[model samples]
Target: MTSHRNPAHSLNWHPDWSSGGDLTLLSSDEIAFSVPSRPILAVSPALRPGAGGLLPLPLSLRLVLYFLDLALYGQLDFLGPSDNYLTDVLSLAGWLDSLGATSLINLLLVSGRAQRWPLAVEFLLGARLRRTDLCREALNRFNDDGRWRDTVWQPPGTVSDFATLCPRALPLDLWSSVDRRFMWAWVVADVPDTPPSFGLGDKFLEIYQTP
Candidate 1:
């Protein structure tokens, strides 16, 4: 059950974790038992494991991307309200949802995978995303209530703040919110809590600002 961290991609791995505890549905609710039904299944070349028919994962890394693959194949029932197979992963004793934003995006923002499962929002977020349009797609996927909805097991957030994105969405756009604090999960994942005017949007902006 040991894990290693790769902060650049914000991913952690347990190279030899091949045990039976891998429930059909993870507690994180990132993947599910049905994904073949979606018509616009999102795919990415970046996620491919390369020519060997296996992800040429980093040396000594035996990461089990089982949940990720399930989403790729479209087994995403956790996103829908109809699905009730989820098991709570978060253990906050006295925490409340006043902080807003329970999007799975927050979990990915911090844990690389939705390991802890944030539940402030009513729906799951991130499940069928194209790496290229992460932000707008997220914005477009927002329900009429202005909250992001989940319908699949897409990665919660960009692999890194520096991950490529559209020039116009601008990283700064993610802030300016009283709720949606999950988005902040990315800004503070590596560190702790948002720093004073840390202006993470600027870091995001810088990524796009450069050639």
Candidate 2:
């Protein structure tokens, strides 16, 4: 169905999506986005239109349209290093159950692109996403990159406390798994066979302490 954009409705129409849109979606805030059916349907099979080729979803217009744009272009670099942006991307992907978007985000998180982010961000995102590999990668970075640890110790006072990074404390089981990985890394290191009491002990206690 063809949809017309009305500027008076405060409708922010995206140039690319507005051009080839067949499916019309209504956001919770009453914004209308005319997006192509092909790109969204290709990734989200469960997404369907109602009468008049319209679908109402409980999401902000930007949330819905941004996701569709990502699906349209299959771009991963759209993500920012901030936790909120990453969380929003993952939340939208999961809500839509779009495997393509989910995989794209996962790949982005695990790639060199994420390496520039604070290892704490990587670790927390990994834990939040329940991807063990990412947690391990962050821990591995901590072991390899002394600079990361130094930052954790002397956080420029601008960064958020590691303990306050994520909204919720990691589940006890996940914390235990990460703790085990840290212990394993220490075991395999060439240093004297002692615990992480050197410097990492305080960092771990400060950050990963389970509630």
Candidate 3:
């Protein structure tokens, strides 16, 4: 009698698979048993094209792009202090973190540069700033300490306060929770005061009372 061979044996399977076809698909446990997953890919500025075209950028420009990418991806400490790059990097990092990138907030906290305190406060009241312990520690060092004037007490209070106080702190939609809350509180607290009438109120009303 002639026997038929199984087609499963002829099929190729990835290392991620158990045998072949969907019959022996890799399970979650099997995947965990395999090689460890690599870290998330970071976009490199070296891979980016310049104004001239798709060619290697200048060293200075490359450096700037690298830091900017890191800041965008919420990886700020990767940027070091060279040619005032740290200032720009920290500022950008803070801005990114303010926009809900918690990873950048953690990086900025560990980097230990208080120069970004204003942005940090903005993040504290708005962004999902992780590592609460670290964030509080950094705030204490940068704000609660004697550096309050330089960091916390800038011209405007929150984003709205900034807009009201400066008119250029941010765009209209950039209001923070603190800003809205403070404004609401101000409006609620500001009761209009009644002025003293110079003459009798009855006489004033008589001139136009339902005539």
Candidate 4:
């Protein structure tokens, strides 16, 4: 949150989405925006309005507006004010599962909006959302690029290069998920169980036995 500003004259409201709305959503930064609740309520049963006061969300005004704008209007280009901002939008959508906005983001990504964006953006969003379906969508794109076999699987680069695939910092849990599922798929397809033995394997086994 930045410095608190006057709610009435805050610079944080959405310029296009703040009018003709039925709900007053206040963000943690004390910025308020008027957004329609009908579309959201139709899709999400988790965001019911409270008795009579404005709804408060524990997100920045930018994020809240982005979520509402995307969810209600199916707008994909209104990314908020920051570098690599889609990551933040995906994070907020993933956290608010009850909002039912994740599907909209997923749809936009798979429906060609993500082609202009980094392919890794979809992959990282999948990990953030904990959706294997989304993860597979990203994986299929990578596979289509011929990177799965040539670069990701049998690489001069290592499996850790998958981390490099992400333009932003990778969280430990998401990385673990990617390793377990994403890399495991490649390993299963690429690794052979045969008589061929490698010195590095022997060395690793020896180190494990010594410990």
Candidate 5:
């Protein structure tokens, strides 16, 4: 007796086409799994402005912005601690408040250590210093700490009088021993190392003597 073999089963299987593999063979569904159909979420853009992006303004300013926005449009409170500090934007807010655009007086007060002393002083003197009580308070604090000599070598008018009223908090001997150069350098250059007194003094003297 002769036996006949099925053509499909008799054929040899090869995986590579170049190696005589059949291209018509279909892969079993069990070998391949279905892919997910969920859509991808898009990212939102940043809202803050300036070199450091957002949060560059002091804490007080951020708080003021929050309350001001609430008072302005009867809109939902959106400003928060995470809000960015745009100085120009804040200045406009101040102007709007000045015109009674909002009920809340938007005053961004910055209170920090001596690290911000010079900048604070310049800001205060710019236009806000005309508000005498606030100016006096800031000056009094500086003089009371014996930091006036080091921080503000030649302070504006009446500042010297305030300094005289508040005797140096530290001992005279201690104050004398403390390197003036180092103190000035720390204030001006934000440097940590002690510098030469004569050199520092000469450099600062020009600034102090300037009209």
Candidate 6:
């Protein structure tokens, strides 16, 4: 919890599924969120070379800590302001730290839409650039989602260096999911649009015709 804003605005909301919990989702203006799980880690800014962080906690050893009993006992109010300025940067950074640079670039674009630039830039610069089957799988699923429509595909200004990030490009496995949730970020950044000299355009065709 960032603990900087109103304590209630942070990850302080209790999920409404426990005892005395009403599983009613509020309109976007309300704060009752049904957010999915994100990764967990803590680190510093990337611009300052002296700032410190470590290799991410591997995905194989994933651990989720949700205290259902605690939420049930407290029954905390789920309502709060709709503004994302109340978003906890520290919490967002922790989640971003768990993903590689390739994925972080996409997430940063999403955060940029919410105006969480502090966390977005932090994740973008610090993220590791690696392409794995897992990343490909996740991207494939995103391509299938309604959110991937071109109208909403706005990535931030931070993804311009994708060519330098991964030079030896690999082809996408059309049969597999290929997690390209943030592919639009690269497009908006102009790195993958022209098929960079870096040799990694295998995913360009299918992702371009995502419909």
Tens digits of per-residue lDDT, candidate 3, 1-211, equal 1121422111111122223222111332211112123111222322333322213433333333444333332233211112122333232232333344354444434433323443443333232333434434444454334322211112223555433432332234433323332222211111123221212222212221211
Residue 19 deviation, candidate 3, in Å? 63
Candidate 1 per-residue lDDT over residues 54-167, each given as its tens digit: 234431111223333232222322322221211111111012222223433542344333332322211222111212244444444443246432321223344343223334
Model 5 residue 77 distance off true place after TM-score fit, in angstroms:
42
lDDT of 5 by residue, 1-211 (tens): 1121322111111112133311121232111111133111111111122213224654234433432322221222112222111221233333332332112222222222223343233223321312334434444454456643333233222423322322332223323333332233222322112222333333323232223
Model 6 ranges with Cα > 4 A deviation: 1-6, 11-131, 148-211
On the 0 to 100 scale, the lDDT of residue 93 in model 1 is: 9
Top-down TM-score ranking: 4, 2, 1, 5, 6, 3
Per-model TM-score versus the true fold: 0.25, 0.27, 0.21, 0.27, 0.23, 0.22
lDDT at residue 66 of model 3 (Cα atoms): 44
Deviation from truth (RMSD, Å), model 6: 17.9
lDDT of 4 at 46: 23
- How many residue pairs clash in each candidate at the backbone level? 6, 0, 0, 0, 0, 12
What's the TM for model 3? 0.21
Misplaced by over 4 Å in model 2 are: 1-102, 109-112, 118-121, 149-211
Question: Residue 194: error of model 6 in Å?
Answer: 29
Compared with the true structure, all predictions reach lDDT values of: 0.28, 0.36, 0.29, 0.36, 0.28, 0.29
Identify the superior model by lDDT, candidate 1 or candidate 5: 1
Local error of candidate 5 at residue 113 (angstroms): 11
Minimum summed lDDT over a 10-residue window in model 6 is located at 60-69
The stretch of ten residues in a row with the least summed lDDT in candidate 5 is 38-47
lDDT tens readout by residue for model 6, 39-153: 2121112211222121132211111111111121221222323211112212223453456665655543432221322222332243223334434544444555534324323
